[model samples]
Target chain A: MKTETKAVDIDRDKGDFAYPEVHVRDAGRGLSEKTIHYISDVKEDPDWVREFRLRGLKTFLEKPLPTHWASKDLEAIDFDKIRYYLSPGTGAKRSWEEVPDDIKRTFERLGIPEQERKFLAGVEAQFDSEAVYSNIKKAVGEQGVIFVGSTEGLKNHPEIFRKWFGKVIPIGDNKFSALNSAVFSGGSFIYVPPGVKVKHPLQAYFRINAESFGQFERTLIIADEGSEVTYMEGCTAPKFETVALHSAVVELVALKGAKLQYITVQNWSSNVFNLVTKRGLAHEDAEIKWIDCNIGSRLTMKYPGVVLKGRKSRGEVLSIALANNGQHQDTGAKMIHAADETTSNIISKSISIGTGRATYRGLVHVPKHLKHCKNNTECDALLINATSRTDTYPAITVRGTGNSVQHEASVSQVSAEQIFYMQQRGLTEAQAMSLSVNGFVNDLVRQFPMEYSVELKRLIELEMEGSVG
Target chain B: MNELRVENLHVAIGDQQIVRGLSLAVPRGEVHAVMGPNGSGKSTLAKVMAGHPDYHVTKGKITMDSEDLLALEPDDRARKGLFLAFQYPSEVPGVTIANFLRAALQSRLPEGEEMEATEYYAKLYEKMELLGMDRSFTSRAVNEGFSGGEKKRTEILQLAMLEPKYAVLDETDSGLDIDALKTVAHGVNSLRGSKIGILLITHYQRILNYIVPDHVHVMVQGRIVRSGGKELALELEERGYDWARAGADEPVLTR
Candidate 1:
């Protein structure tokens, strides 16, 4: 029998409260060269970094929204009305006691400190446009592991940070990536030295506490040869009348014989548009894995990709998405095999409830010269109501000899008979619905860390409440 | 009034009348066997009694120990001590038997009170052992890829674990081999006690040789035409359901 923990008290409105904005720096609403310059000046960006921002801003203005195949919701994002940047100016604190009271209380309410104390090797708490508190455990620091805010990493470890910065995902990769590169402020930067495997995960929590604002954080992690690390990040935003935009760019690099696992659990409120660009590069004999769970967003478009650049490297993506009423989750994965003898796997499961919609778009490619490459993709969608919707589009191209690729997709509905069966066994309608949903994603959930899996289950249960009569 | 009683019951599925003016009572500490032919609505009666949403009770009253069962939701009715063993149990993929039973039992507890894990596992293992199920059976998905006999055994396993005040077993022996049927019957028979009532519905009297109900009722179309002691099952077995259908044209008020 499974050990039952007390039901996590995740009230539906737990993340609905916000504090008054107290910022020493606020680049007024709208995006332009002047806004990028203001953000660069306030953040004390170096000359080259400033130039990079200018180039990124130019690219952002040139690229258009990907409306050709994407949802028409892309037309709803009004960049001119969103505040590009806002920072408290107090910089990151090394101690929870030193954090500003208002910001500290927000993280406390989110249980960040307790989580850090329990199992995390380090923790970074970012509010709005900057990291308010960042600290790594002394034991981990002694092992030469560097975990810090992205700005600090750029200043202190330019040798490593600059080498991989915007390398995995270029500045002009997409409109959102370019937008994030232009005004990015707060996200984690992590590095593990050669042959040093971190025993515990490092975590980052991003909170949006302002209205009509856009949060653009840049995160980059590099694992040296023969090293291993796992990093997890979570995001949440309070409900707002006006739309909030969260556009982030995350790049990961795994050198030869190294291993890296990155996980993200995003719980944006109903009025947030979460468009993010995340990708990783794996060297010879290295491995990269992405575990993602998305819920509680108005619309989200993210497809974390992995480029296998070295022979015998491996890449895997396991994702779960749930779309409640008026929400759309368009998420998937991409694997580009650039070397021979590489393998990649992608498994995605999505659920749609009420008028919610979920779509899975995936891509897998193996060039003609890449021999002995393999890829397997599986996408499954579950619809909870008559009005719910789901779709899948997988593009696979394999052109080399001795290479193999397979794709499978399915759509299912939670039948009335199934609900009645569970109900007759004493589960309430909502409870039965949650149980069925959890069951649908059980295999993928088993791949997450214990704490995250528990939290994911609670979030799903909270979303299922009030969804049934 | 320690009994499950259906009075002048009429149930339908979207304009298709399935159970018409049927009435029966199974009191605590007794088992009532319902014998019927194909399309006689035996399964509909069981589903309706357990509050399946598709079957609408246009005119009826279902009560357990003087409490109105129809007023409650299916889950509430189950917690209020009613159970139904489906003829074709649904395959709840990825939900283990252990977890499903735990949720069922957990729903019965007062809010904020949790079932102790040790005591629960001990009880669960004891029930599985009584049903001749291996310990690992708890980890398999509920009824997914289960053999015909395994499904029936699972139903009995749930019945034993929940310990409901009343149960309606619908065609519990339809696809079981003799050995599997005997094992399942043994599991059900062990749970017979003073605090529980059971309504066992079956097409064949063969299961009666094992479960041996205290009362037997012959139903035709939608109503019971005859009621008697255990010997009624044998008489019908000898004469076939054609004997019962001969009188179905006229309603017999056996109550």
Candidate 2:
């Protein structure tokens, strides 16, 4: 028997996930050492944070550009041409009402305030380099839930933050993470008290409205023993003629008997390079789940992950990525089973239309002596046009015996007969293609938070339009 | 009177002619059964009728209610009221039965017209009950991992839901047991009426018992050579088609 809970799951934010109608005065100067130092001097960060940025800036200068995958996209981002920073709103607001008019208008267009008022336990809106508005509901605050920007978390809870920061993903984990660690500004910091089950979700919004800018945010969530929390992060960059950079680092910690879910829906215009690092740690009997959907961006490289550090832990990554013209969504998940009796399931679905390409690059590693572990992975890609391309490169490393790992990958065109069958039922070829595509990702789409799922379907529909015609 | 008529239809794949000038007609409200040998283009005819796009309709015209079915795109032909219940229904991963049917039905509406979700589900449940299908089946992917009988039953369910002007059911009883055959045939039998015409293709005579046909045809080498009543199925079932083909393959005066 199945327990079905039905609530309105459609029209998930009719306008919620769209790029903010942000007005920018690109009427500005370019990045320089002076502006860099000015930025360091403005935030009033600790001496160590300043030195860290200076060192990172030097590394960012000396390090060669990424030469491996997605090199063409990496070449498009011109650092000297980028502005590096912008302050649309000066300081964080204790309440969303205190946010400025223009930024407030932006969120109003993106449906953040209403979403926060209606559903979320808390909401964080990061304007340019810092979160301008952050407020938690009284009931959630009563539960001792810590929700704020990562900058604040580092400033206030340095003892707890420093120990875990850069631990899972070190400074030089890759070229971009190192860039993020150097100049990271706003993101989110969440802590669920022990035994506290936050029923409502907490969400953060990241918007980059300036041209030739870099928005690096860092988010961390630590769900304590026996706690549960669902955190969501969404990003939208303005439609710019020049390339912008948005590199983020998200770390999640699920302690013993705890559950932590990290969800992201990124829709940057085709002029942005969205490279991000997201990973979580799951302790004994803990669970970590990542539901990621990538719709827009010139190129995106993110793989939300989970490390099973405790026995009997569970990890899952469900994703749906739609790539249209001029987009390359190279995203998937990672699962590492360090302890025994851990189980992991990864389902990745992608649709490539026009000249777009969607790649599923994932990893599942079960170390030696990990008895009774199970890993199942299934990746399916649908090529909507002859020119479109899709690929799946899943690395499943099972080191020890007594473990079962199953991996299946397939790339196929729609059956001409299936299209005809649906068309015969009165749908046009485009409608049939849309129906088939929807069905292709229905299993993974169902895993999204209801509202998000609806929005996802609509976004896919828009992405597929005119492909068949 | 409206009709789904195949006129001297010939279908070929590459150089091989799978269907050879076969002719048949199913007027509205009647059910015709074409029982053929292992292949004899039974499934091929069903696919070509559904506009499978794999075979070339080298020499044929499929018309529904006086409309040239072959002249239209496959999906266009379908929207104009032609449906094919596949013998091997493709398992559409991730798409639920309810959603697929909804898209099909929604496509039938006039532009800008919307369907009422509540009423659609109510009618869907009623049709599901008639087919003896569990309501939970609506949430399952279309034919994904279904049993033989379940797949056939799903075809029939789609037939009923679509309410097409004409339906070409290809090998609808191949994998089903007797019980499933009865249930599936019952569903088909219940849908037979003035608004819909059915052309049932089968390899075995077993299904004809439950779904009695108004006319029965014997197909051999992609051509239908004999037309008779229900008794012909028994003749072919008991005597087989080779003798029938032998009866017709007489050497004519060298002309």
Candidate 3:
């Protein structure tokens, strides 16, 4: 791992944007009341949203930085130096051909269009801070499934967006959440009507092209009664010398008898700080699941949470985190059982290579009055080198008398004997090590959708190269 | 000679000498059985020949087809036609038997060349049928949750798939029942031909009954004390290892 900071000045006009003649309009550097108002004016948000942003900004300014957890990396981020909002000087295009040439080139490289044609029912591509393109299949749109940008949803579908926005995860949920609420921009807003099931997944692609940028996307998904939907999002950024910050707030509401699954696969550059706050609310007999995969970043702290608010609801979180050299991945899940007969399960797997560090911080709570609320949490960590590190801190409060809870954790290293065994069978040492690491997380990887699961396996193989001496 | 030859082999694990000045040679088309008591260093000799990192070769020359076998890595040695069927095979979780064997075979190919999946699976099914293994075993993790008999069968399956020029079976029959013993012995016997050499290391003579050897050698204290024909095995089984241990006490250290 190269610890020295490179001298490369991030040229936003270089490899990502080949058309240097294309102008990118931006609500320039720094975060303050002025920047927030400028973003609101650019998007033409309603008065309530502008006020909401101002209040969020005030709350963010007052809240102190977290001192106890992942503080070192958090302190490295200079809030004043980040570019809060940026646009390619192009509005969201409904047709692929209508998108600008340079922006289209970037998504084409990311295979967004190819993926949308295959398994995704809808696609929304966000470059920097604004969504450049969004489109849903005609049949899916006819099914009363609304998929658009958060800004568009607020302006076009106010009745549907205003009722549930910030109801699950409020603006002041955390410092980063408040920060996201203040400078929030281009993220997906999805709503499935009653009894409507979206057969295919809706995907969002987020790319940070500029240097010293902060991408604060606010996503809200609402599944009405007896509805079901799956949404997946992926993000990446080019390697730059300076730091980039990504703080997003995602709120999900699964109404009575509804089922919703939210998946995220984040592979940011090594100079990015990815801190996110995500939470879901499940009503009676509803189900909410979070499937998350984190592969690369300088530092990341994200724990998708679920609040089972009504009777007999269920929640699940299946996550995989891998931290290569010069990276730290802090991720886990939170489940709150507020009603009787609710259940939740969390399975987290982490891998640390070279000098990387992975930390699993989880919270599972079943109150005293909530009878028959069950929970299970499992965490497994694999260390690839002597310097690799991992930590597990699980806080479980099980006060219910009739509920059953099970927790299991294990930390293990790849045994040299196993490597020799594989080598004796003719596999090289690197292949053997990667094989074992894949096996370590195979069960969890099997749960991911086929498109991302295959990619995740290939990514693991890439990271495992030269991992062993 | 087209064979595996060990001349004046002296190996040690840490400070304790194991294979002390041992010399043996098994030419192609022949099966040699090494029978000895516990702690006689028979298994150590097999490991040393396979280049186990823990067992240091203090002084020895191991040659396969007159090539320096000691100068290569274990995987390279395997690619160069060397195989070791462990007495206790390690479990590789999450790595299916099919993938493990495919990788092992893939290593032998030139770079940028891919093994044909259809041909590989067809050959795997044939070998599995020969060993009486269920076809479903290929998809299961390699040797994980396998019974003793199943582990032995998988070992032989790999041996059949790899088709190495020389193989060292270190106590392959240690934990097999009679039926399993017959199946494993049949699997090994099918591989016996003029192109390959086999060395069977065992503490008991029971396995020799199923797969008869061309010659028999009694080892004690890391050196061969007696060498004879197949009838010697029967004599040792009847009289026990006390004869070999008594002969071993005379200190036959000369190569």
Candidate 4:
């Protein structure tokens, strides 16, 4: 029997639309001390936040480029040529009417507000660097849940904000995290009160409307004791001849007996370099899951991690990545068993089409002292074209005597016989190919909410067009 | 007259000929059983009819109702009403039987015309019931982890749903028990009518007891050695294929 009441289920937003440029303030083509301070001053940060930004900038400069893996693609991004910050000058709009005409049209075309009105508990839409609109249902708000932009959350609820800020994933966690810390402007900050469960998902839509620019949003989600919440995010950028950089840092905290599920569907354009760091800390008997899907990007390097901090905590990561022509998706999961009797699971599926390459790099660790800790990891790859490529590197460390870790990985080509079988059932060759590729990722796709599942299927079908001649 | 006719069909896999100078014809409303020993190319003939890319038809003429079947792609042949129940059905992981059947049925409709989901599901359930399949089976992946009997039953279910004008069932009874064989044969028999023609290929004569073919042909060395009524299956069952092989192999002086 399939249970639909899980904490990490799926949902979706529809439509494909973008608006023309309107940049009121552009932190012009460069990353320097001045650019960092410029972003800080524009946001009117407190003394400590400003100092934190400068320190992050220092660390980002000192940290060398990632030389181990994905280095060749990393060299393609020109940091000096990227604009650090951009905004349309309009602040967060409380009403749909309050939003600018062009930006409102863009969101309308993307069907953001319609989805919010239909099912989302709350929505925060970030166009460039700042969220242009934010809203939460009154009933959910009355339940003492707070959903707002990170900047606003810092200003309004500093006590709650400062307690966990940079705590789960501190600065210097990685080079991209450092860069995000230095210039992060807009993302969601959500806090669900103790014992309250938010039924519908809280979504954040990240849109990169400007070319040759970067959007670094920071998200922090904290579920109080015994509370539950699901947060889903989607991202897209317009196609550009030059590279656009999107590097984000997300920190999630699940207190004692709490549960949180974070989902991301990133469909950036082929010229976008998406490097992100997302991690969660789970307390006693708490559960944290990251359901991630990466469909588009020139090169993406992200591995959502979970640290099981207390006894009997549970962590999971379900990931699906598709790499098309001229794309490389390097994604996986990391689980750290810090307490005894904890459990973790990681399932990653990827598809590489027509010269595209996909790599699964995962890490699972159980320290020597933790007893009865268990982990299961499965990574499967489907190569659509003969020239398509895939690689897997799973680094598992088990030190304790009572720990059990099972890791399985396989790479398979879409069998010609299977396609022929489907084709013999009256489907065209392209239809057969799409069905096979969709089947390759269907197990993970089912974990999504019904609407998102349908949309994901459609997106896959569109991507599969012309994959075969 | 709807008929699938093959005239001196010669098929090869690479340089090795698998089906050499085989000729057969199945007209509408008729059931033809081809009983052959191992490697006599019964399965190869079925695959060749399905346009399997592995098999190269060196010289042959296959026409369905005067349309050249060999020139069409596999899917086009299927859409034009040719079905092949594979001896070993491929396992399609993660694609549900319901979805797979829907895609097949949907492809037969005109472009931009959607299949009525309620009507489609109703028909699917009716066919599954005819095949003695549980309703839950529709949600399972197509042939993934299915038992031998279940796989064969699912193939019959597809044949009923497709209602193809011509179906070549290759070794559909190979791995089934008596009860499963009865169920599969009943499903195939239920679809029997004047609009459909079935070519049942098998090594054993057991399934013929249930399906009761209209005619039986003894195949040896990729050619039809003998043709007779349904009683011929019983004759082959009593006297092994060696008699037919020896009778058909008397060297003819073609020069």
Better of 1 and 4 by TM-score: 1
| Reference contacts reproduced by model 4 | 0.84
DockQ class, candidate 2: medium
**Chain A TM-score for each of the predictions:** 0.86, 0.81, 0.85, 0.85
Tell me the TM-score of model 1.
0.91
Top TM-score prediction, candidate number: 1
Which is the leading candidate under lDDT?
1
lDDT tens string, model 1, A25-55? 7788998989988998888998878888888
- The reply for model 1, stretches above 4 Å from the true place, is A1-20, A89-137, A206-214, A235-243
The sequence of per-residue lDDT tens digits that candidate 2 reaches over residues B21-60 is 7888889998888888886788888888877778899997
In order of appearance, the predictions have TM-scores of 0.91, 0.83, 0.90, 0.90
Model 1 per-residue lDDT tens digits across residues B1-255: 999998888999998998898989999999999999999999999998888888899997989998999999999999899999999999888888998999899999999689999999999999999999999999998999998889989999999999999999999999999999999999999999998999999999999999999999999899998889999999999999999889887766655
The weakest ten consecutive residues by lDDT in model 2 chain A span: A8-17
**iRMS for all predictions?**
0.6, 1.9, 1.1, 0.6
What TM-score would candidate 3 get against the native? Answer: 0.90
Q: Tens digits of per-residue lDDT for model 4 on B87-201?
A: 9999888999999999999999999799999998899999999889999999999999999999999999999999899999999999999999999999999899899999999
Evaluated on chain B only, what are the TM-scores of all the candidate structures, in order? 0.98, 0.95, 0.97, 0.97
Q: Model 1, residue A448: what's the lDDT?
A: 91
Candidate 1: Cα lDDT at B218: 92
Proportion of true inter-chain contacts also present in candidate 2: 0.82
Fnat per candidate: 0.82, 0.82, 0.77, 0.84
lDDT of model 1, residue A18: 30
Report the number of backbone clashes for model 4.
2
lDDT of each: 0.84, 0.76, 0.82, 0.83
